[model samples]
Target: MHSSSVSGSRPCLHSFKTTLPLKALAFSTMMLPLHSINASKATYQFDTVVNQNRLIVVSVENPTTVFDKTTHLHGFGYDLVRSYANSLNVKLEFRTVKDNASALNMVKSGKANFAMTTASFQAIEDKHLAGFSATCDDSSVLEDNGLNVNLNWVFKHANDPLSQNASAYICNTKQNGTISQLASFYNRNVVKDESWDIIQRDLTNRMPIYKASFQSTAETYDIDWHLLAAIGYQESYLKPNSVSPTGVRGLMMLTHNTAKAMGVNDRTDPSQSIEGGAKYYDLMLNRYSNISYPDRNWYALVAYNMGPGAVSQIQSRLKAQGKNPNSWINLYSYLERHKASNSRYGQATQYVTRIRAYLEHIKSTPQLVNL
Candidate 1:
């Protein structure tokens, strides 16, 4: 259970008008893990989180909703909850679990204050969980009895004081368009649109072919398997034999020089290409160990695409403009602006954003997790 306090009064940041990287880092520092809290068992109740020094949230990690393994909590849910926690002046902690069942169980067991998960109404009724409809993200659950219920997170009790605050936060943010801005800033693409439809179609049809290779690469390099897969999708749309005009080939679209460097004997072979990509990406990650998790991951992705020299130049540009060199948004904005002058750089920018959108979709949707 990693926890941190955010002090000082500052307006919650908007997309383009966001505060500096220092401030963003300050607010985004809250996060979680799960364990028995017998010591605080007596004090553990849903409302106690507000009264105590911390706001404990239990959730599963996904690119958009959560970053479970990172040193800091980020993504969409973190932003929303950070606002609510700061308003109450409590340190926030997100207790991450392996699945929705674990998240709900923690909240029900009083090990957590609130849960962000989805369930059929019958499951909610059976577990006696309180789902806040306002917080729904257009997801649904199919009941064991074959009924569909809107996806939702639940409170411990119907009348828990936390419910009122949570509901207010959702409605207020929705009315102010903060939710939309946050979505745009995080995902950087329209959710479930034509492009999304294509991705989904590919996910169902194309992803299964390459899933095991990615998983194997993940175990070897200790990277998120989905992230590598997402990169592959962005590169060649998951075509195993894809070839760029410049001769970068295969699922990962590795250039011949890069493939040889990574010891990939055949760039057109899925296993060899994916292994080469993973090895190359691992090399980039090693260079970025000085940075933090999640940020380091993003920076490494940029390095992998545009080369570390390019990343250094971009960092120099950001610093010259008084921006944080380590800030992804700053880097993203710089890339967005310079893309007109350099189409390659712009593609690199889109590369990351599209990967992000794909990751969010894959992680948020339960059906896509295993596939």
Candidate 2:
């Protein structure tokens, strides 16, 4: 059978399909349900992968893979494939690969339709066949012979174990949970828990005093006021009298030197502190101007905590490794995989993550705005 042809080639950042027999095998494996193959293949003019009665996806077990302990078969790749399978009302068959070579070999050998590997694109490019990863956003799909085979290739650490059984990489998804649930596992649910009612109420009461400062400073910086508010709350519960053991003072917790650098005469003054912090944050955002949204904001928060110089160094290292240094997710992953002694990855992660959570909470609590 003559397979559909592809004109331009792009690196499959998140996913890819094979050529020749491998392509044929992918179609055969992915379009398992007879009903689907018979029902849509003719109209779509493509071998059914999404709406097929059965969908097959192959991936190696690693940190980025989403696996369910109860099911033990599906990982991150499974979750991604499951989303399509669920949407198409199809059944999914999850397959495993031993290593990067073996994972792609599944595609080459026709045992699996598509594969997911948490190995770096550069490593894959160096070791395996040719494939291009375009732009380095979240995930890139592989297109072959006009077939978009959904491959979830999450890059892995260099020191990660060779075998799934031996690997200790953090799998971010589980077979039992929905996509929202999986996302929550990684990004964390920012909403406030009702259990913290008293603390939240106290914080809500204190919002009015500094709300204007946050609003004005955030507006001046063209930033979300809630973000500044969240940072203020996290730093000192929005209290101007607060001081840290490290001698950082004020609602935004700037050290004496940083306060001077930002032209703030009083670090303990809520308005000056908020303005200085916002100005400093604006600087970080400008420095990482090329990074995309949400990720850029998250990276800026990291730079705010760990300093821009440290983040810049990490970004350079990421670029050297053929990864996008502008991506907060990629940077975080790199930091997690390769421990950074110069930067406080854990502390910074918590700081940014908590601020995000607080920001979400504040956004949801419009009543707090009234206060």
Candidate 3:
């Protein structure tokens, strides 16, 4: 959250008018020595040179609505500024405002380089700011009638140097490839569109099913029946009585050692095997807390299929490459890079890749949820 009030008043300057054109005024003002400014003017002359390379501080809130991991920041205001900076060869900095009020104040006080969010025009119009670029097209339904609340980018006073450059770029660029890639990733990960819903309906009609459990000391943990069924599908196509050539057993496919650690009396028991498998998954998730969620879920699934230590080694390699240790792309890329090598690391990468692809397939299909 942020305070609604401005922290301090802006300094006032005496009024002055310049006959010079905008570009000339900008050039003349920039040429004047930094400390030698004519202090009496209400409107200071703009400085194109100094302002051209200036850093634009774009603000967003935590749990940023602008850029989820799958969605690139380029689709949002961040990308707008980034493109501007690239064109101008200037620098851009991102600041996370504590909340909406702070974001508003940042624009009002000229503290922010620029600000955008899912912000409504009415909420910020009175601040003497320039609202350019509308982001969201519509608002949530209200009373069954279509309602619309526009999301916009806010700049300081209309001709503020930062605002000028940002506006120019926003007017020119069409959606970039970065935006498409991000949208694709988001669709794959978070937003299961209409196709997925249809698949879920079909799967429901089919009701392809399996079951598993874990029991120890007189206590029983029956896995979510559907989850157990999904896991069975992934492991052995719901083969309740199946056994791996490597000595894993049952519908959930627990090894004898894993069954022992989970206190499962029998690896062959469907209920026990499922329970042990789910417990092992829980343990993997706990082990990788530093990884982001949803992604962490994917990594844990991979680690469950491959060992945790092996995943840790891959994470180490990813960190060395300046990639996110927990990101699926980074991990997947590393896996592909190492797949042909005969080294132990290469073998681990191969295993992780297979597990990730399996998880991706499972997520893509509609047989599982609550993942």
Q: Give the Å shift of residue 291 in candidate 2.
A: 0.7
Q: How many clashing residue pairs appear in each of the predictions shown?
A: 2, 14, 3
Model 3 residue 31 distance off true place after TM-score fit, in angstroms: 14
lDDT of 1 by residue, 297-326 (tens): 778888888888999998998999887787
Ranking by lDDT: 1, 2, 3
* Top-lDDT structure, candidate number: 1
Pick the winner on lDDT between candidates 2 and 3. 2
Candidate lDDT scores, in order, read 0.65, 0.56, 0.49
- Kindly state the number of residue pairs that clash in model 1: 2
Instruction: Candidate 3: give the clashing pairs.
Output: 14-42, 213-271, 213-272
How far residue 130's Cα lies from its native spot in candidate 3, in Å, is 17
Q: What is the C-alpha RMSD of each candidate to the true structure, in Å?
A: 10.4, 15.6, 13.0
Model 1: how far is 233 from its true place, Å?
A: 1.2
lDDT of 3 by residue, 1-371 (tens): 01121111111111112223334445665566666455412222124224555654555542212432221232234444454555555556666565666786876665665676545555655565555533212122111121112335565554444444444444334222232222222232232355546544543543333211322311333223443344555575555578989888876687788888988887666666666777887787788778644456556766777677878888898889786787654564565457677365454444443333333444445444332
Superposition TM-score, candidate 1 onto the true structure: 0.58
CA error at residue 148 for candidate 1, angstroms: 22
